[model samples]
Target: MFSRAGSSAFRCCRALPPAVFRVSQPVQYRALSSAAADAAAAAAASPRHPARPTFFRRALSFTGGALLFTSLGLIMVLGPAYESAAAILSSPSDAESLSLFTPPDEDAQAKEDFINSHPLTLSLRSDPDFIESRPHMKIPPSWRKHNLTGGTLMGPGKVAVPPFSWSEKSGKNFVQITHVGTDLCGHMGIIHGGFLATMLDEGLARCCFPVLPFNIGMTAKLEINYKAPAMANQYLVLRATTIKVEGRKAWVEGHIETLPTEEGQEPVVLATASALYISPKQASVSIRR
Candidate 1:
């Protein structure tokens, strides 16, 4: 019975299958390796891209990111300058003539007619002080106020010298200048405030020029008061007088008025200014013609 039992146990053990163990990589790891190899091979086969961006591509690009950045840059660069230019060049209102759309010759004829009708007979040319200073009081050689090929600050693209005069009171000198601002404008129908300031600054310096020790003057400070709107394509007069001179500094007062060609309207005060001019003792600057 023992021999039989032992033989049966041996048979049972043989009947059971032997244990199996795996030595190869996992299925998931093998698949991952294969995919990585394929991707690297594909990348190597393709052409390389440029390292730098192109100008036209960047400027004209309509891509979402590109458009957004380009628009932001433009807005940052040109805000006030663009607004001022737009307002200056916009369509003319009723008060303005149709010369912007008219032919050049016709525009000239119209300007001639206006000037002839409202002649500057008593302008700067006829002023006693102006005649006296003609020999030494030269116009700044680089006074390039845009032309018909461009634009200007006076008399329909042609700046002419109007009445100029000077006086002395309590050892202070006073100067008066007259002009017709027919072309310079910021508002469509009215004059530009900046242009008015420009006129005042230049006139103030000029007033001090004749009296300055070196015949050279520079603006240290300028303050303006705009009492009324100065009109474009109309006659204007500016005057500045020296209030006092202490060492290198001088104080000046000036005012601008609109000169009406018609009989009913009196001259209107448009703006006023007070300015300080100074002469540097040691300077190495000179202007060229």
Candidate 2:
């Protein structure tokens, strides 16, 4: 009976102490609290990269901008169905019609001034031989009317002179001709240099024309040295001298000079020329038109 009492007492003591034990008021969660504190500290530190701009900030800022309609433009130009984005660029000119001022009387005055100033014209009044000078009888009007050029005969100008005048002294052959620059303008007021060159070429051949057998010659090569401007409407003087006549080739030297405006003033040298004229073959001389 004593042993049974002792066992009962031990069991009752264990059950009573377990019932008396209680959980303390809930302990704060360390994991959740530490995470929250770390997050707050990080927010307070300086940022490495700036945050993305908000829509409100973009709307308020009027700074340098991106092309907002960029996607729409790309869709229009590089689309499934192409649409050309090139702008039409064109303009009309009214420059000719809207000219502000009229040009001077360049043609008439130039012609008159050139003629009146020519020294050859003054000589014509004093020297009868100069006045008597005329084209050689050998050079027919048909030849002049069918004057030779690159390969064709040039027609008469708007104004024409009477005929070429020829005279000679020593070995030099002199030819006088007058031309109105208004009729042969390379530019508006200037006489064509090519026309002057053609005249010089003719002077070269005509210097030795009287000595040729067939009365026909063709220029092989001609070089000109331009010295001064040849004005329009001037009575120019061209003098050529035969340097030598070697069988079929005739070498000639010539000069073209402008008429001086005043007495004792040297004539303005316009150009110097040298040429080689060769007798044409009989076959080349036959008339073709």
Candidate 3:
């Protein structure tokens, strides 16, 4: 039913290449597919932003750190105290050792009375040389805490009681009276010569200290002469005199003697000593002109 012109146009369209139309359609589809695949790859490769921590999580972290530091601080501060308490309470040997380091208790009135009422003490008190100076019943507390004397030698079975002393007002002379306990003996009954020497050295130094440029001195030389065996568990007397003083130097002589057991009895000399003590040059220099 087509006119001749229409039929001729139809024939021309059919003559166009079917292959060209197919190639054009496939090229468009390939471009659309590649674009969609590229978009998907880009979305996968992008970095994502992490969510922020909540308030409770941040607070918990801070609190945990604070608690750890506080615990460490407490350990640092209280460690020694805890150790001391544990040593004192838990270990018997440690407690006993600590007690040894502690100073002796102050003398009771009865003990004081015994030393105060001694004939030597009374004589010193009545003497004109010591009238201006009061009696001292004990050594310095610091000396009593010494590791050697206080811890080892000054206990119930050794020195037993605090020594009594009297110093002259002019610092020229000093006297000490004390009872040596039975246990202070190197032999079965005789007191140790070293112990006697220690007493003499300390006594002589003390006798001259007040007369020195400073009230402190070190023994530069010490000489001891043992006279007789000093029996233990007996009252003993030490008398020291400052022989000479030249600037920071002092020469002192002293002797240890047995206290007379009865009236009119001559005291037995046990040991004699002489010593030279010198104050520190620095301390002497610091003295006011």
TM-score of each: 0.47, 0.47, 0.59
Q: Which candidate leads the pack in TM-score?
A: 3
* Backbone N/Cα/C clashes per model: 4, 1, 0
What's the CA RMSD for each of the models? 15.1, 21.2, 12.8
- lDDT-superior candidate, 1 or 2: 1
lDDT of 2: 0.59
What TM-score does candidate 1 get on C-alpha atoms?
A: 0.47
Reference-based lDDT, residue 64, model 1: 68
Tens digits of per-residue lDDT for model 1 on 120-181? 43453344444222211222222223332113433344334323344442325444434444
Clash total of candidate 1: 4
Residue 56 of candidate 3: its Cα lDDT? 100
Candidate 1 vs candidate 3: which has greater lDDT? 3
The worst-scoring run of ten residues by lDDT in candidate 1 lies at 132-141
Considering lDDT, where higher is better, how would the candidates rank from best to worst? 3, 1, 2
Off by over 4 Å in 3: 1-112, 131-143, 284-289
Give each model's whole-structure lDDT. 0.60, 0.59, 0.76
TM-score of 3: 0.59
